[model samples]
Each structure stands twice: as C-alpha cells, then as structure tokens.
Target: MTKRIVVLGVSGSGKSLIGKSIADTLGYPFFDGDDFHSQANVDKMRQGTPLNDDDRKGWLATLNAILTDNPSAVIACSGLKPEYRAMLRNGLDDVTMIYLKGSIDTIWQRHQKRDGHYFNGREMLESQFATLVEPTEDEALVIDISQNADAVLKEALTLLANSPTH
Candidate 1:
C-alpha cells in the first residue's frame, strides 16, 4: 500500500533532503512545500518576515489538497505549529508525519553555510525557532536531527517500514 508522509521541521532541519531520500527509497513522489508557496509569500520570507497564521492559511489548504489528491506521496514542509500540522492532515486518512527535531544552534549552523536560498539566515533563524511548536508524543514520528542525513533517512524509513501502513 502507498503511504502519505509529511517530512516536517523548522527551516534548515534537512526536511527537504531527508524527505526526498525517503520518497525515493519508497518510490513515492516528493513534493517540497516551498514550491506551493505563492510568490508573495516567498518574497515575504526572503525579507525575513515571519509569516502570520493568516499568511499561511491558504498555503496550508493548498498542501492539504495536494495530499488529498495524491495519497501516495511524500511531502516536505515546515509544519511549525500544531494547528498547521492539523491543517496539513485535513482529509488525509493515511498520513504519517516525520518531525525532524533539531536544536536552534544546529539549524543556525546549517543555515549559515546554506547558499542560493532567498531567505536570510540570520534574520529568519530566531523567528523560526520562536514559532516552532515541537511535535507531541501522540502526533508524529520524531527523529533527532543530530544524526547525519543518511542516518536520519534510514531511521525514518525503518520507522515507516514498521508502521501500520507497511
């Protein structure tokens, strides 16, 4: 059976990298949530403005639609808040969320060396940290980000393999 998984984390937590790997390994298409953002929203992030909930509502709705439409897929998103994760989960009966848990310092270091991204690392780092509401025990699979990318991906896949869907 195909499974829908959401790779969630704060920015710089390797959601995109790990999500893609997991999707590839499982032969599921990967969708980066950033791609669903409107140009205006992208611009706002580029300017280091933390998006208010209102700014994210439409985008979350759009993501939920995509998940609903393609039930056999993996998605990478910064599901920073509990409500946002619930929004992403809307109407998706078969969904597994993998939260890439990381420290602010680790994320900050990763962001500092990151290049070719529109977001300014220093400006957005604090806001990302501030806005993050870590996953609850009942909510998702939590993977520590202190591990290497490959290790993280492997761990996630192992968890998924043992998951009820598999």
Candidate 2:
C-alpha cells in the first residue's frame, strides 16, 4: 500500500523540515500544508489571528483532494484537532500519522527566529495549543521534537515502520 505520512504538529515544530527529509529518504513527494490554505486564511494568520474551524473546512477539503490524488506523499500539517485529523483522513488508507510534540517554550522560541513565515510571531501558537487535541498512540506515531531533526526523522521512520497501519 502507498504510504501517506502526515507529519503533524503545532507551528514551529519543524513539520515542514522534517517532512521534507522523510520524503527525501522515502522517495515520496513532499507538501507543505500551508500552501493548501486559502489566501483569506493566510491573510488572517498574517494578522496574527487564529483560524477558526469554519475557516479551515475548505482548506482541509483541498488537502484531502491532494492526498487522494497522491499514492505516496509526506505532508506537513497542523492536525491539531481530532476532527481536523479525521477530516484529513477521509477516503484514505495506509496513512501513517506522525505527531511532532514539543514544549511551548521550545516551539515559541523557534517561532520567534523563523523569518517570512505567515504564522507570524508567536501570537497564534498559544491559540494553536489551546485548540489542539493531542493525538493518542492509536491515532499517530508520536515523537518529541526536543532532539535534533535527524534524530526526530529517524525515530519517526522507525515508529512508522513498526506501526500496524503502515
């Protein structure tokens, strides 16, 4: 079965960087979920406003379509809520979810240093955490992001390899 790896986490948790590395290692396509968002959503985020669930429906559908089309792909997305994750899972199988977990201070520091990110500053990160429903073991392969990217990627691959879903 084709593997659909969703590298999920809060903003600044290195989802994009880690997802790209995993894609490179697995020889699959890589997608940044931020690209799937509508301009309005981007605008709202740029203004430091958190996206409400209503604002994300279309974006989720678009990502769902992209995943449906790709047999094997690694996508960096903030699957913060279970409902949001479920929305992403519609019509898909062979999905291996990786939750990149991290402390607020660590990620907030990372968020501060990042440049040209639409998730500007650390304003919405708190909101993101507040909105998040951390995925359990049954829902995703969880890995802490306190380690280096290489280590995180290695662990994610190992967990995916061992996961029943994969």
Candidate 3:
C-alpha cells in the first residue's frame, strides 16, 4: 500500500532532509511546506515576524489540497498545532506523522549554521517553540533530533515500516 507521510518539526529540525530521504527511499514525491507559502507570508517570516493562525489559514488549506491530491508522498511541515494538523489531514487517511523533537538550543545551533533561509533568528525559533503543541504518542512517531541525521532517518524508516499502514 502507498503511504502518505508528514515530517513535522520546528524550523531547523531537519524536516526537509528527513522527509526527502523518506520519499526517496520509498520512491515517493517529496514536498516542502515552505515552498507553498505565499509571498506575503515569506516576507513576514523574512522580516522576523511570526505568523498567526489567521495568516496560515490559506496556506494550510493549500497544503491540504496538495496532500489530498497526492496519494503517496512525503511532506515536510511544521504541524505545530492540533488544528493545523487536522487541517492538513482533512479528507486524507493513514497519514503517518513523524515529529522531529529537539530542544531550542539544539535547533538554534543548527539554524545558525544555515544560510539564505527566510526563517531566521532566535526569536522566530522561540516563537515556534512557544506555539508548538506537540503531538501525542498516538498522533506521531516521535524521533529525537539530537542524534545524527542518518540515525534519525534509519529510526524513522524502521518506525514507518512497522506502522499499520505499511
């Protein structure tokens, strides 16, 4: 059976990297949720302004549409809130959520090393952490991000392979 996966995490939690790895391993398409953001949202984030739920409504809807359209794919998204996750999972089934759990300091250090990204600064990272409503054990396969990327990917693949859908 085809599997639809959403790799969830705050910025710099390696969502894109892991999601892409999973997609490639499974021969599925990979989509970065950031790529779907509107120009205005991008500008807001670029300016170090955090986006409220109201600002994310349309963007989330578009992401929902993308998930709805693709039967078997992986997406890297910050499914920070329960409501947002629900919105993304609307009209979909058997969507495996993988949360890349990490501390602010850990992610912040990684964030600092990256370049040319709109989502920058410690404040923005803190805001995301403040806004994050972590998924319950049943809601997502939680993976620690302190380990190296290869270990995380291996663990995620193992978990996904054992998930009901797989």
Candidate 4:
C-alpha cells in the first residue's frame, strides 16, 4: 500500500516542509520540484520574472518522469494549473494531490522570512494566484494551512489514512 503523493501550493505555502514530513513519515523519497528547475528558469525567477507556460513545460516533464519512475514518493510542487497537475499525474494511477490552501497575506509573511530562495517578491506570488486553478474536492484533498505545521501534517496524514484510495 505504498502511496504516491504530490503536495501542491503556491510558493511560501509550505509545500517543501509538509511534503518532506509526509515522505519521511511514510518512508518514501521526497523531491522538491524547485530542485528540478533549469538554471535559466531559476534565473528568471530570481530576476523577478514570472515564468510562462513554456518555461514550465520541460520542468514538469522531468517531474512527471520522477513520479513515473518512483511508485512511492512525495513531491513538492506548485501545481497551479489543472493542465500542470494532469501532466504531473500523466501515467500514475495512485497519485494523491494535497493542495495547501493559504491566503496571499499569509504566504507573504512566510515569504518575507525566507532566506536565499530564488522564488521571491510579492508580484510573483500574485502571478501564481492568478494562474492557480484551485482543485475541486474530487481533484484533490485540500488542506487549509493557517494552522501550525504540526497540525497541518497531522491533518494531511489523517486524510491520507482515511482516503478510500489508500
């Protein structure tokens, strides 16, 4: 009963933190989608440029391959669009998406505390929200992230445990 999970959210929405926790708890590998970005894409984000769909295509493909290769793993990715999520889950049957829902102000506070991260600026966060097509209940198990990290992790784990698919 291995689980394949993708923690989805905008930058600063605790994707990496929660995804890693889930992976560690489940004894599965954890991958940060940010690590898969090309140097060019990283530079663009660093320079405060919003990446269009073209910039994300190759990166999404790589992440998709990772999911395809690893049957049981947790991935942290800003899957903002329905198409992007579809691409990420292209060939995976048991994939579960956990969307970390948060407001811009909440995420902004979190982003301000970040250090040396490539994805920066308020405008970038705005762009992500604009691009985001929130998943419906059927598309994902949405988790509100205003709570403490421990609580969020507990909720996520509980949800996964109770999920009919699991």
Superposition error at 26 for model 3 (Å): 0.4
User: Where's the lowest-lDDT run of ten residues in candidate 2?
Assistant: 157-166
- Please give, for residues 121-152, the per-residue lDDT of candidate 2 as tens digits: 66699999999999998898889999998899
TM-score of each: 0.95, 0.96, 0.97, 0.97
lDDT of every model, 2 decimals: 0.87, 0.89, 0.92, 0.93
Clashing pairs in 1: none
How far off is residue 72 in model 3, in Å? 0.4
Alpha-carbon error at 5 in model 4, in Å? 0.3
Candidate 3, superposed: residue stretches over 4 Å from native:
none
Which is better, 2 or 3, measured by TM-score?
3
- Would you list the clashing residue pairs of candidate 2? none
- List the candidate numbers ranked by lDDT, top first: 4, 3, 2, 1
Clashes of 1: 0
What digit string (tens of lDDT, one per residue) describes model 1 on residues 109-149? Answer: 89988888877766687888788898875788889999899
